[model samples]
Each structure stands twice: as structure tokens, then as C-alpha cells.
Target: MAGGRKPCRAVTARLRRSVNRRPGTASPCPWPCTFYSVVAGHLDGGEEVKAAAIRDAREGAGITIAPENMRVVGVMHRRAGDERIDFFLVAERWTGGIVNAEPHKCDDLSWFDLDRLPENVIPYVRRAIESFHRGVWFDSFGWEE
Candidate 1:
């Protein structure tokens, strides 16, 4: 998805980027957040982007979907390091409905149980979710990091 058309930048929030506490203190990013990673071959990214997406997903936060493919992004960055895995999410595939922030960007959004996802899901997404349970988040370029 690559954030659709525009490039995404880190906000650098203390809560979001709490470079405080211990190295492995209570998990860095939030859970259950959504990311908009790319879906293709090859990998490209740094530790920062991966962290953002993982934190977003673990914290259960939702993100805006890109207009290009009509899907929301979700990063599956790992805190332990080595960019474990990254992934993307098609907004329409989840349950519930889309948010009202950007109508054109996203039409059908859903808050999936996160525990039980639907069939035909992207491979990388499945992997990310699997790692999330163990707190072993990884970074995958096109996966959704």
C-alpha cells in the first residue's frame, strides 16, 4: 500500500516512541493497531517503521487505509529485533464497518476479533498475527510494516 500516494512519517510521540523505561519493559508499541504495508516481492525498511506498525497492531489502534487499493495497513514489527515480519490488511475483510475520517480513502472497515480472522488472508498477515501472540514481532517489507 505504501501509504497510498503520500509518504508516511513518524510522529515521534513520547507515548508512541517512549525511548524510556527498560529495553524490554512492558512492550514498546501498543497492540491491536492496523498498518498499511506494501504487498509485493523483495524487502525494504528500517527498525523504526517496523516498530511503528507492531506497536500500532498490538495496542489495538486503527489506522487510515490508503486510497490506491482501498485497504488499511498494519505493521508487524518486532521488538526483539531482526525485523521478524511485516504485513498489510485489506480493510473490507474485517468485521464491523469503516471509520468516518477519510471516506474516499476507506469505504469498508472492520474491527476483526484479531483472534479469529477470515479465510483467504495474506500469508504475511497470518505470520504477523502468529508472532504477535509470542511477542516476537518481525518486519516484512511488503507484508505490512
Candidate 2:
């Protein structure tokens, strides 16, 4: 953790391609190549994991996900120069149309097949999606022995 702060707790909201209006939808984050990523961010202080997922979906993608609509898919303990505990949640159903809620943060929003994700996806995110499909509930990334 940075500055002696506790390990960060984050949430990732995975919107499946089937649930999205179009497949292969991607939101490029000003990277060299267009990449796919889930709606993810740090949990607010005193916020529950599921609540964070719901908030991120609305704030990042303009989708309103009910608590029942969100499913806990995976939990990842990751180290990328710092420690972060990630809660991966899948939104099976939601209301309202999807839009790029944070245009300043992302270019556009799109969906891609989880099974055949593009190579540009952040590696750790891709791993979490694959694990979710495989029925794995726990995963870790960027850790060293």
C-alpha cells in the first residue's frame, strides 16, 4: 500500500456482451490501441462492495443496476506496485440505455465477448472475466512468491 495506507478496495462491474445492445463494444482509454475494460473504481469510504459496483455502473457507464441485478463473480487480490482488493461483479440485468457517462475519463463504451476478449484488454481484467466464466470465485494477480 502507498503511504502506509491500507490496501485499496475496488469494484469492477462487468457488463456481459449479451446484455449490451451491441457486441464487441469497447471504450478506448486513450491508449495506443483501442482496449476493452470493465466499469471499475475504488470503493467509497464506508461503502459496501455491492453498493460500489452499482455506483460505478451508474457513474462510469450510465446504467442503473439494482442490487439484485449485480452478481459477485470474483474477488482478486492484486499487486501492481501497490496492493488492491478487487470485487468483480456481473450485472445480469439493468434499466436504462447505456451511455458514456464519463466522457472525460473514457472515449466511448462498447462490449466484447468475454470468451474472445481483444488482446488490448488490461491483462488482469481479462483474467478475471475468464475466471468468472469458469466458475472460479477467487483469483490473484501481479503477486510474487
Candidate 3:
């Protein structure tokens, strides 16, 4: 269930229908699009659901990088099935902003020294932070296909 290579069944279903199924069925993540949308409304029908992310940055501890100065440097594509991957670049710059919980997606957030991180930081994010310290690179490298 972890770490192997296979074509996306989702993409295959789009190109050739299964023998037992009809053709032209709409597949998820249809071709050539990385953007999707979901409709949301509050129970009161007066609110809109908005997706959000909690981002934090830390610098020092024998390191010269800063998440506050991060930038989108490159995006590597390896069409696993029907999705494109993204990677953001971070640089060293000083700034001050409290690491707080992500209102929606991230339930908690905090800044940790390179040697010490929050107990609940996502696994993938923790890996990326580690890679930064080792001078290796990781961005969605351990996620998805």
C-alpha cells in the first residue's frame, strides 16, 4: 500500500471504458484541469465555506532559511493519474508572526526550533522541514501517487 509505481486507474477509465461499462462516463478530475470547486453554504444559508491553510515559518538553529521568505520556485509534474503536483520554495528572511492554528484545515499550528517541532505537525510537512535542514528537497514527495 506504500511506495510503488502504477498508472492512475482514474486516467485509464477515462481513456478506455471497462468492458462491462458504457462509454463516456464522466471521470473524476477530468483531463487537463488542476482546479476544482465545491459548493458550500452554511446551515443558515447566509455563509460560504472557504478553504484555508495554516502556514508558519521559523529560522535559526544552525539554519539560514525562513518560511516567511518562502516562494514558489518550482513545480514538478509526474502525471500519476490525473493530478499535477506542486512544491513551494523557502528562503531565509526574518519576520515575526505567531504560528496559530489553521482556521479550517489545520486545527493547530506552532513554530518549532529545527530540532523541536509541534507534536501535531502533519507527517509530510515534518518531512519537508527535515529535508530543508539536510539540504535535500521535498515537496509533496511522499504524498499521492
Candidate 4:
């Protein structure tokens, strides 16, 4: 939503990995974590947005999700001396399993509760999750205005 600049389109997935608890505890714990990533050059020229989401989810997290199973959860206008638009999607159902497709690029891919996310998560990604829970459809970050 900046001036006349066309925002770059990107997609991220909020795939809930699993549930966990302390070593001997028997109580249900919060959702372990949601998946996320900046689509890795998979968005071909004018490719369908949902298609890109599916591809990203597969390549980044090793999950195969259909377009119909995905939902746009939030959009983030992110700036870190540069600006871009990110589309966040949530997929509770998918075929196949989760794996680190790009192990070289990711050091750790573990489940984390939203209330206790890792300190190293991308700032915009975290904000997008917060916005999703708040039912905020749109948000801007790293801008003074």
C-alpha cells in the first residue's frame, strides 16, 4: 500500500507441526508451531497465487497442500530499508509429511508455540501471525507512518 510502487508478491504457510509436552507431563500443550517461508523463486510469471503457496509449502516444508485447503490469513507490508508485500496462508490439512527440504538454508525446523516462538523468527513473520490471530487483514511494518 505504498504510493504507486507495485508490491512484490510472496506467500508463507502457517502449518501447525505438532503438539508436545514436558518429558513426563500428561497435559495437552499448545500448538507446537506454524510453518513459514518466503516463496523461493517459485512464483513464475503471472502464476496463480494459490499455486505459489502450494509450491512454497512443498519446497520449504515438504508438505503437499491443495489450493482449496489453503486460506489467506493475513498480508504484511514489510520494510527493512526495502519494502515488499507478503501473503500469509494457513493450511491445517495436507498430504505427505513435513521435512526440511532445504537443510542448508535452515539450521533448525522445530515446532514452537505461538506464545513462545523462537527469538530468531523473522520480525515480519511474527507480526503476520499476531495479525492473523487478531483478525487484522492488513498491516504495515518498519515504517514511521
Compare the candidates by lDDT and give the number of the best one. 2
lDDT of 4 by residue, 1-145 (tens): 5787655545444534321111112312122223332333235557766788788778766878887898887777777555666677677789987666655555445566767765655556667767776889999987866
lDDT of 1 by residue, 7-97 (tens): 3333211111111111112223222223321221122345454344333332232333223323224444433223343344333322322
lDDT of 2 by residue, 1-145 (tens): 4677776546555546522221132433333435557777777789888888788888877888899878887888888766788888878888988897877666657777776766777777778878887899999988867
Top-TM-score candidate index: 2
Question: 44-63 in candidate 3: lDDT tens per residue?
Answer: 22321111000222211112
For each candidate in turn, give its C-alpha RMSD to the true structure in angstroms: 15.8, 4.3, 17.6, 9.1
Candidate order, lDDT descending: 2, 4, 1, 3
Which clashing pairs does model 3 show? none
Better of 1 and 2 by TM-score: 2
Give all candidates' CA lDDT scores.
0.33, 0.71, 0.29, 0.59
